[model samples]
Target: MGKTIAIANQKGGVGKTTTAINLAASFAVLEYKTLLIDADPQANSTTGLGFDLRNIQQSIYDCMINEGQAADVVLGTEMEYLKLLPSHIDLVGAELELINHPNRENVLKKIIAPVKDQYDFIIVDCSPSLGLITVNALTAADSVIIPVQCEFFALEGLGKLLNTIKIVQSHLNTDLEIEGILMTMYDGRLRLSNQVVNEVRQHFEDMVFNVLIHRNTRLGEAPSFGKPAILYDPDSNGSVNYLNLAREILQKNDATKITNQEKILAASDEQRDT
Candidate 1:
């Protein structure tokens, strides 16, 4: 089964979409079959991967609202192993359209079910809101990667987002957990940025990623050219940081798998002895 990670932050301008694009790209570059779902109506992830929204006939909106097959809408990106489930501007209205549906929260989960096992990782880029759309993303994800901007208001609204995650865990997806909290757009030259990073690390501790995505002009410029940082400029700071982030995620996942296997073997040994 594939691991589904929803990249979310209720606060706008927090580099949520940037992380979604680059992290997924990094996974693909590392030879992992990765799929990115542009759940946000803005479709930034789609465009960031060099896709034109106007050119796409079927999008994630169709898959969620019109019962369109996810496999049919999946588009190939520039990267060999990366794929995208493009989003449309029409997705803005899906929240109201599915408002009355009994299982609205699980709509995305159902939409992506048939194709979930085909990839090693599936990343969803959520809009900056705790609306029905974000709820759907949460319900469909096995884990969440929250990107927090390294600024003065970095901790603001974090409690509310965490509360929302708890609600989703309790009522929707019991297996969902916070994969990690990423510190993005950090500027070492700025005293406040350093303070914000320390504050966040102090609070989240092990939950915070070791890789700090420093504020770089190249990171901001890559998206406009419709390419991820890794593909746009592999030697840039933004590209290097994101690659480190990907490695950290892979190592952590490997450690988790080994730990789980050890537990299973220990149980089997006990059973045999008994």
Candidate 2:
């Protein structure tokens, strides 16, 4: 089965959606089946990939509410292995609608379970809130990846998010773990950027990846042009960084596979000896 990861953070302008779009595209380029699930009401990830939001008759909102099946709502893009679950304004009302439902936090998990094995990676771009919608996203994810911007208040909102994760692990989803913390909007020339990086590393240590996403115009411009940085400007620094992040993800997946294989072989040997 594929790994379902939520690229989430409660802070806006932290590159969560951008990371989701670009990373999904990058993974597709690497020959992996990838799905980008837009749970954000704004539908930025959907539009960024050139989808007309109004025309996407069904989206994640409908899937969660049982108005439609999850697989039926997946929209194809030009990329061979990349698909999108588009979002729309209807998503804005989901929090209020889902409040009274039984096992409310699990709605998304149930909706996505049937299709989990169809993709190599499922990336959910969560809304910038700790509300019910985001709770649903967190509840459904196997791992959470936080994108921290390299700014003065970089660590400010992290505590609340960490607390939420603690609650989810203790109550709702015990098996969910932090995938990694990504440092975004890095400005190599600024001393404050370095300071922010040092402070985050002090708290997260090796949990942060070495590849930092520098503040590049192409990253910001691509969305307006309705394309990923990779498709917008293949040689841009933003494109290069996201591609490296994709490589990091695959490397981790490969390591996990090797570890599992070793465990299986050892188990077989034990069975034969018995």
Candidate 3:
């Protein structure tokens, strides 16, 4: 199965959905089957991919609450290889409902299991909070990609995030790993942005990705029209950066091929044994 990652941060306006949608677009461009999970109630990731939010028949809430069938909620996006499991505003209440369930933390994990082997990657755009929804995302994910916006108070909410990850690792899912911490909306012209970048790198060190996404107008504009920067303005710096991120993802996963193969074999054996 391909790696499943949650693009998460408790702090809002840090571009978590932006990164999730664009990254999924990037993966689709590489001919990889990518499923974008809109775990957030805002459903920005769903609209950002050009899916009409108003006319949805089935939503992620239906699947999350066990009211609707899974995978049937998938909507075809403008991109050929990208599919979106759209969310609705009702997802805001899903956390409270999920909390009472036996596998509250792993609600999403169980939902994703049946179709985990179908895609090359599954990217979840988590809500900007440390609530049950975020924990659900963390529990389901194989890895977490943090999108840290370069600005003041950037690290203010991170301690809580790390603690939540730790809690999930210990009690919810042990295989969860930090895939890469990305620095987004970087403005080299601003000293503060650079400072945030440096400070974060000092703490994360090699765990931080080498790539840094600079602020670009096209990046901000694409979502307004419901398109990824790649298709909206393919030549823009933001588009290039996301494409580069896909290449980075491929390279990193390629280096870990042996481990992935072992996982596939193990999964196969488990199926046979069952």
Winner by lDDT between candidate 3 and candidate 1:
1
The superposed Cα distance between candidate 1 and the true structure at residue 187, in angstroms, equals: 0.9
| Candidate number that wins on TM-score, 1 or 2 | 1
TM-score of model 3 (CA atoms)? 0.91
Error of 2 at 43 (Å): 0.6
TM-score, every prediction? 0.92, 0.91, 0.91
lDDT of 2 by residue, 62-94 (tens): 887765888899999888889999999989998
Candidate 3 clashing pairs?
none
User: Candidate 3 residues 1-274, lDDT tens each?
Assistant: 8679999999998889889989999888767889999999999998887777789878989988965655787888888889899989999999888877886777788788888898989999999898988898999999999999998888878888988899999998999999899999998999999899999999989888888888999999998899999899988889878877877877887734333433554477589899
lDDT: worst 10-residue window of model 2: 255-264
Point out where model 2 deviates above 4 Å: 255-274
| Candidate 1 ranges beyond 4 A from true positions | 255-274
TM-score of 2: 0.91
- Residue pair clashes in candidate 2: none
Best by TM-score, which number? Answer: 1
